[model samples]
Target chain A: MTRFRLGIEYDGGPFVGWQRQENGPSIQQCLEEAVAATVQEETHVYGAGRTDAGVHAIGQVAHVDILKEIAPARLMAALNFHLKPNPIAVTDCAVAADDFHARFSATGRAYLYRIANRRAPPVLERGHVWWVPAELDAAAMHEAAQRLVGRHDFSTFRAALCQAQSPVKSLDRLDVNRVGEEIQVIAEARSFLHHQVRNMVGTLRLAGEGKWSADDVTAALAARDRAAGGPTAPPDGLYLTRVVY
Target chain B: MTRFRLGIEYDGGPFVGWQRQENGPSIQQCLEEAVAATVQEETHVYGAGRTDAGVHAIGQVAHVDILKEIAPARLMAALNFHLKPNPIAVTDCAVAADDFHARFSATGRAYLYRIANRRAPPVLERGHVWWVPAELDAAAMHEAAQRLVGRHDFSTFRAALCQAQSPVKSLDRLDVNRVGEEIQVIAEARSFLHHQVRNMVGTLRLAGEGKWSADDVTAALAARDRAAGGPTAPPDGLYLTRVVY
Candidate 1:
């Protein structure tokens, strides 16, 4: 058996998140089916992260094992051929050691959140961005984001349905910047509590709009209560950018 | 009646084109109907450029006359409210002289052609860009593009059904550059023959792919015949970036 690591890009608008669900098609199922069709074997592909619905990805990583002896390039082509009509694509593929588990072997993950700060609604990026008509002070948001960085018990930012046992995680970086009409927030971490990034962005947004201050964000973290945090940002604006092993 | 000049932005995926075609909805129709609904009077909005189907716009200009005494900000808000559910927005509006025609008074126009130079088809930018799998030398294409940047008869690049009386037009700029995995071509002119930008991109792509040389591009221009040029690029990658008056 040969194990292959695949780099993927997808438009998550039409998906029911990454994990398989009874509601609709998932990115995982699409990729697994495509691989099964390519190798003529019912193969199961494991992903590094199971992103939520309407969340995009640029460099999502996955792994699958198959018995076929095919070149990585040819396997990529055949998988893409069968994956067509779906918005998922295996952009890169490489041979991997049998022990290289996609999820367990990951060392870090990164995410990007896009906010369109303008009076007018989005025309081209309607479903891909969060539209905030009110002006956001990115500088304030950046300052507020700093208070959430480093190791902390992020219980206030954790989702209620999160499967993780502990809320303690080390946040490597959180950056907020304004580029033209969009305000972007990028977060990197070894691992994240469910909805952690979204919760942080939501609180920073409140700070940017003058509803909260840096002190408020710090207090929320210290409170360690979900009710003390801001609302969860929409999934449409979130993107799983990369997963580093 | 007060004449207003409006700056517009739209995603052309759902529209037939800029012009009002009987087969489907057009951007022009959408704007006119929205304005009429806001002012409670039938209004006609004229655009500086009429983009084809699946062609996007970032800074399209238009002129409209309204009998209602509404401020620019209010007019923008009211028109946008009426234009809801459509991927079109009036980004800016200003009062203009009665004689300021959107089409006739334009002194220059700019367009951007985007090609995703990658192995995999674009997922996030699927409708917004053209995906080309082959590797391209953008620097070589840039050098070749400079040869077509003067006043000349652009018959080789003009569409067969172009309505321009003369093929001779001043080509101000045809700059090409590569940013990461994307190749962008920005073209500007006082006015252009139909399919002029797309035609140039198509031919330049040939040079980028090593199918044609810089000398061949010069020879095609010297020939001044439509058959001497390469094929027209798809409309999906073309964007009406700006219109200068």
Candidate 2:
């Protein structure tokens, strides 16, 4: 058996998330089908992150094992050809060690969230960004984001449906900055709870609006309750930027 | 008559160019309909540039006359409210002097062209950029682009359908740079012949691939024939970035 690691990019708008589901199409299903068509083998495609619906990815990583003796570049080309019309692309493909699991071997992950902070709605970037009509103080949001950077109980920012065994995780970075008219939030960690990035962004937006202080965010985190956090931001603005191994 | 100068932004993907046509929807038709709904009057919206289909704009300028007495901000908000779900936005509105005309009074116009220079297809920016898989030498393209700048008779780059009285126009700037995986080309001019920017870019792309030199570009310009230039780049990568009056 040959193990191949793949770098993937996709627009998650149409999928039912990264995992396979009966409700609708998924990134994994498409990828697996493409692999089957290329190698005539039914293999499971394992992704580093299961991104939610309407989210996007630029540097998502995955792995698949096939018995067929196909070259990596040839497999990538075949997969891309078979994944036609779908908004997924196999950017890079390489031979991987048998023990290198896509999920378990990932050392870090990074996510980017974009907010169009302007009175006029975004024309070109309609679905890829969360349009916030009210002006946001990006500096305030940046300051508030610093409070959630270190290791702590993130239950306040966790989703009720999250299946993570523990609420405590070390957040390597959570930075907020304004780029042109958009407020961008970048987060990095070893792993994250379901909806953690969206929840944190939603909370930071309140601080951007001057409705909450950094101390208020700390207080909310200290509450250790899902209801204590701000509303979850929509999945449209989130992007799985990178997965490191 | 109260003349209003409006700043417009649009994703030109859904329109049949800027002019109103019987074939399909147009940006002017949408903006005019929105204005009619807001002011209860049928008025003509004059634009600074008549962009082709699939061309986007961030700072497109237009002018309209309304009989109603309304504040500029209020008029802008009302127009925006009326132009819902169209991927169009009225970014700014202000009362203009009687002599001001969106098209005739414009002193300069700037356009931006984006090329996704990567092996992977763009997922998030699919419609907004041209995907060029080959590696492009941006420095070569930039050096070649300088040959097209300055006052020149641009008949080589002019479209066959161009109706301009003269082919001579002063090109103030043409700069090419690589931004991550994307190649950005910025062009500025007092006025341009139809498809001039795209045509210039198409020729410069040959330089990027090492197939043509800067001298070749100068020779193409000196030919003064539409057939001498390269193919016109698609409208998808072009944007009317700014209009100066």
Candidate 3:
């Protein structure tokens, strides 16, 4: 058996997150089904991260083990041929050693959140970005985000249903910037708690709208309670940009 | 009556085109109906350009005369409130001179065409970009595009159903550039013939794929016959980016 690494891009609007669930369809199920159809073998696929529903991914990484002797390029072509009509594409494929674990061997992950800070709702970017009518102070949001960029116990940003054993994680970067009427927030980390990025974005949005200050964000971190954090931002604005190895 | 200039944005996946077509719903009909509902009056809105079916717009400009004495901001909000559920947005609105005409008074129009040069079909940008499986030489495409720049008779590229009286039009700029796996072609002119941009892109694709050479593009241009040009590209990848007055 040969193991293969795949680079995936998907529109997560129609999916119920990456992991297979009884609730609805998932990116994992789609990939596995495509692979099964191509190789005529029922196989399981593993992804580096299981994104939430309505969360997009441009460079999601996955690994699958198959007994087929097809080349990497042909495998990519055959898989894409079967995955048609669905908003999922395997952009790249490569042979990997059996030791390469898509989830365990990953070193970092990057995320991007987009906020359209204008009166009109997004048109071309519909279902892809958050629409905030009032103008946001991106500089203030940046200042607030800087306060959380370090190794810390991010209990305030952790979701109540988060299954992670600990909230302690190292945040490598958190940046906020504005371009025209759109505000972009970029975050990077070795790992994240459930809804951690979205919760932090919600709090930064409050600072952007002048409802809260940087000190308030600091206080929320100190509170170490889920209620202390701001509301969770919708999944529409979030994108799993890349998974670094 | 006050005339207002509005900058519009829309995803063209649903609409037939920008014009009022009898076959299917059009962006013009959607916007007009939304505006009429908001102001309680019938209004004829004119757009600076009429994009084809499946062609998107990011900064399409339009003008409408309304009898209501409402502020531009309020008008924008009300129209958007009614235009909801449809992927159409009035991004900006301003009071314009009564003499302002959306089509005639426009001094420049800019368009962008995107091509995903990769083996796999696009997932995230499925409708937003054209997916070509063959390897593309962007440098060759750029060189071929330069041959079509400046004033010339673009009969080889114009659609047979084009309403323009003359095939001669000044071509201000046509630039082709590659960004990672994407190829972006930007075109600017005061006006264009129907299917001109798509036709040009189609011919350039042939050149980029080694099916045709730069000299072939020049020969096709000099032929001055629609049959001499390459196949017309689909409208999905075209975008009416901006209209400058």
Best by DockQ: 3
True contacts kept of 2: 0.76
Instruction: Provide TM-scores for the models.
Output: 0.99, 0.98, 0.98
- lDDT string for model 2 (B78-164, tens) is 989989889889999999998899999999999999999988777678889988889999999999999999999999999989999
TM-score of 3: 0.98
DockQ of 3: 0.92
Task: DockQ winner between 1 and 2, please give it.
Answer: 1
lDDT of 1 by residue, A1-245 (tens): 99999999998999999899999999999998998888888888898988988889988999999998999999999989999989888889999999999999999999999999998888889889999999999999999999999999999999999999899999999999999999999999988998898899989999999999999999999999999999999988899999998
**Candidate 3 lDDT by residue in tens digits, A41-124:** 888899998899889999899999999798999999988988888899998999999999989999999999999898888988
Top lDDT: which candidate number?
A: 2
DockQ of all models, two decimals each = 0.80, 0.76, 0.92
Better of 2 and 3 by DockQ: 3
Model 1 stretches astray by more than 4 angstroms:
none
Residue A137 of model 3 has an lDDT of 100
Give the TM-score (vs. native) of candidate 2: 0.98
How accurate locally, in lDDT, is each candidate?
A: 0.93, 0.94, 0.93
Q: What lDDT is reached at residue A159 by model 1?
A: 95
